[model samples]
Target chain A: MNINLTLIGQSITFAVFVWFCMKFIWPHIVHALDVRRKAIADGLAAAERGKHEQELAAKRATETLHDSKVKAAEIIAQAEKRAVQIIEEAKATAKAEGDRQLAAAQAEIEQAAHRAREQLRSQVAALVLAGAEKVLRREVDAKAHADLLEAISKEI
Target chain B: MAGEAHTSAEYIKHHLQNLVYGQHPDGTWGLAHSAAEAKAMGFWAIHLDTLGMSVLLGVVFLYFFRKAAIRATSGVPGGLQNFVEWVVEFIDGSVKGSFTGRNPLVAPLALTIFIWIFLLNLMDLVPIDWIPGLMGALGLPYFKLVPTTDPNATFGMAIGVFILILYYSVKMKGVGGFFGELAFQPFGKWGMPANLLLEGVNLIAKPVSLALRLFGNLYAGEMIFILIALMFSGGAVMFLTGGVLQWAWAVFHVLIITLQAFIFMTLTIVYLDMAHQEHH
Candidate 1:
């Protein structure tokens, strides 16, 4: 490798190329790389934020579900309680109506029994007074006989 | 200046010369540190043509990044943004694999190295002489296009890394401790002479390997491009074939450039990680 024009040209060219690369090319490359790195970091941060928001929403939904379930159970229990109360009231009202009708029927039966008993007693007294007069074989006054019959009936 | 020896070839040679001032031998690589002739110093100075193109590409990339940054969305990403993200993830994964946790400097440094070197390598894929030729047409002289192709530039980078690695190794393990590790390693508690020799070999090899690997790949690529350009200059048929070949080579070169940059960055991380480790 003698010292020649070609070698000299190559050397000078190499130097110039290097200077250019260092001054212009390398800096841009570095800047681009830096930008890329920052973009990735930003993406990761955004993803993390989104994940956190998703978790928070899930937690809130669970809380709301629990509250709603409790509310539903409370409403059902109240309805059941109201239904039981209405049934008890209807039973009590039916019992009271039945008692009133039974008392009225008993009173009517008693009054009918009393009237029948009075009629029977009167007929029996008349018959007993007739039998006594016949057995004595003598005619008696109607008022006296009626009094004797009444006394006999009372004794019987 | 316009003598018989100072023909067009001489003029070309004069302009092609590195810009070194006084107290420097002629027909040698120019040294900016020495006070040389202003013309010699300028020859070695920055080639503005390639610099402008490289900077233009960089500006374009910057614009792209800014646009992507401003329009970045969480829901869906565009194609360009996706590509950018993929590159970052790829580099991050490689770094993560190479370096252990809590290596605060490793990731950032590795990232910088990867991006910077990747951009440098990508420049090789550009029409190798396109920038320089354009500059020549525009009345500019001594325009070089590729940087890593230069040994000075590659060595400069490798040496910087070499220093950093040494600093870290010493820092992680105290002065006596670091030296002790080398002596005791590989040979294991053997004779002092054998240990010293082996350790010396091991120590010298690290920086040399790093520098040479990069230099070899870049220099070879630059040479091939120059040869191909010379071939195309010969004939029209050769010119068409050269263009086709250049395109194919560029496609293949994409892999080489990207892979080399990745390897370099990965190796750096690995070396730093190893230095921190208690054992090899």
Candidate 2:
């Protein structure tokens, strides 16, 4: 076939079409793809950061759990030691109270015994003086015997 | 298509002719009813079928792409948009791979050449008679729907690329640098004439080969299709054979058309890349 005006016609059509494509189609489509690409990249980055932060939180939680456990053990040990010391102090107080009460009771009993003994000695001396006066009144002078009896009573 | 009414050679010749419009020697401008009249129309004649069909296909391609472009979104894509974006990405990748230049025009140019040429070549798969017979029934003398089979369309597009190549060459390298590339290449300055001969041929051969290669392949393929279609005029066995052969060739031609389009686009990018490259 002979080449004719169609060649020029087709060239003009092609130029116009390419101009339209460059202006409208190519930039819009490529820009959409680029935006989607950037969106995917940003989404992936945020996900990675979230994973890192979660790991940090997990590690912090474990460390805090370990610290709490140690503090709980320390508190338990202190409570046990305080309980032992309280028990020891109670035992010492009870023993001292018993000793002081025993000492006071012993002193009171000795005092009572001494008073009873003094009363008994006075009674016995009075009874012995009465008996000696009854026997010596029949045998000797009363005045000389009275002095001896008085000295014996004072000794008693 | 009453194939039996005409002789086999007449059928074949009829299918091969274009709907030409030009002035007659008698000073009237109209369609050529016969091959002799089409031939007599000479350089001023226009192949309306090739022009109309190619422009129609181009419009179809542009309409779908423009629809997709108007609503193109980064969030999600519909079926048409996905298909369009897929093709755009493929052409973009081809450009990025072969072209190292920064011209905004090159990629779109590659895309246009690829899709438009592909759309033009796709008409080869149409049953040889559908559109032409329809047009013939409508009182048109002849119609050839596939544009890539015409050298006019191919050379027209190739010349467009050639113009761009020349432009970027002068723009990237100076006009003198562009001439220097043609004058003193593959040999020293002492061999400038020989170098100009060799390099000039090389330079001009880019568009010529690009045009002829596509035109030749599609023309030959269209010719084979026409030849196979002739068997449909024979009796039942030949008709069945023709159908099977037509199917097989069409299936194979799918690869050919796609490959030709890809080659055209790739080579355009490469030639443009060469234009953009500065000499070390």
Candidate 3:
């Protein structure tokens, strides 16, 4: 019941205990807590950044796909246009070739017709001469009958 | 065996007395003395039982906590680690809530006070006769096991807190501000004397209340246990009732012990917080 030196002794003990706790015990625990908190925060931020980058990558991927599709369509369109031009050129060439061949055949036919007409005319004249010779006697004067022959040829 | 011829009053008196070490009335130093002899030794004497028990419990507190602290990890904790973390978090939260200014020492100081006092008070739950009986067998007559039951121990702790409060007040507010706080108050500078007297009492009352609250609760609880033990002598029916009463009281005293420790710790933080604050 009496206040005594025990108070001082216990106070010293209390002070020592407090000093121990303050110096050794408190800092480590609090630092651990702070470290854990920081770790969680950093992890969350990294996850968020990863998600954002993933989204951006996805968007870029889609854009690239669209660009490739458009490029492929353009290439196909160019190929189709080139194919149409080739077909048109081929048609024009074939038409020109056919016309040239027709012209040549026409010329050949014309030449042949001319030759046949000439031959027909020569044969008719020869036949007429022979007929005249058969009708007239052989002693008639040939040089004097030249004008008659020429007239006859002209008549024929 | 000593109770064979003595009255119940003497038994209770014997149980309440501490194993004191002090000077004799003949001016000789001795190991043990009567309570009256301890009083006559005049504030120079020590209660060997209280000091021993308190220091032992303090060591127990330090050892267990230090072990837990060493093994403490940032990862998922084991049962002991979890318990230690929970206690640390609890005290840290209490200091944070009650203490406004930031001092690295406050949280740990609060933790030490709470746990150390809790350990000291827990000795009360030991069957009141167990240690004394054992020590009595070892030829030691008187021993008080619970340190907080002694006014000296509680006052000792409270006085330590009181010193911290004064230190913080002077450190934070300066010496002039500290005195100014005591000298000026609810009435104004015109009532400086009244303010000084009132605030001085208020300041003194903090530690006094802290000490007495714990000491009174535990001492009363110890007395009741002694009384209950005394009840065992009144035959079979009395002994049975006393047994039931002891069980009931022990159960109730658990809350008292823990609550008193918490109150003491909280008040310490609050007082320190008050010192840290500057009120113009």
Q: Second chain only: TM-score per model?
A: 0.74, 0.97, 0.96
lDDT of 1 by residue, B1-280 (tens): 2234445444334333332222223555433332234334433344333344435544555556456555555445689767656665676688778777455566545655566566776777766556655655775444455655545445545655666678888988888778887787666777667888887777667756765777678667766665565556547999898888887878887888777777777887787777776655
Clashes of each: 19, 0, 0
Docking class of predicted structure 1: incorrect
Best by lDDT: 2
TM-score of model 1 (CA atoms): 0.60
Comparing 2 with 3 on TM-score, the higher-scoring candidate is: 2
- Candidate 2 lDDT over B179-217, as tens digits, reads 998887779799999999999899899999999999999
Candidate 3 C-alpha lDDT tens digits along A39-132: 8899999999999999999999999999999999999999999999999999999999999999999999999999998788878888878788
TM agreement with the true structure for every prediction: 0.60, 0.87, 0.80
Per-model CA lDDT versus the true structure:
0.62, 0.91, 0.88
DockQ (C-alpha based) per candidate is 0.06, 0.58, 0.50
Q: On residues B211-240, what C-alpha lDDT tens digit does candidate 3 reach at each position?
A: 999999999999999888888888999999
Show where candidate 3 strays beyond 4 Å: A62-156, B1-6, B26-28, B33-37, B233-240
**TM-score, chain B, predicted structure 1:** 0.74
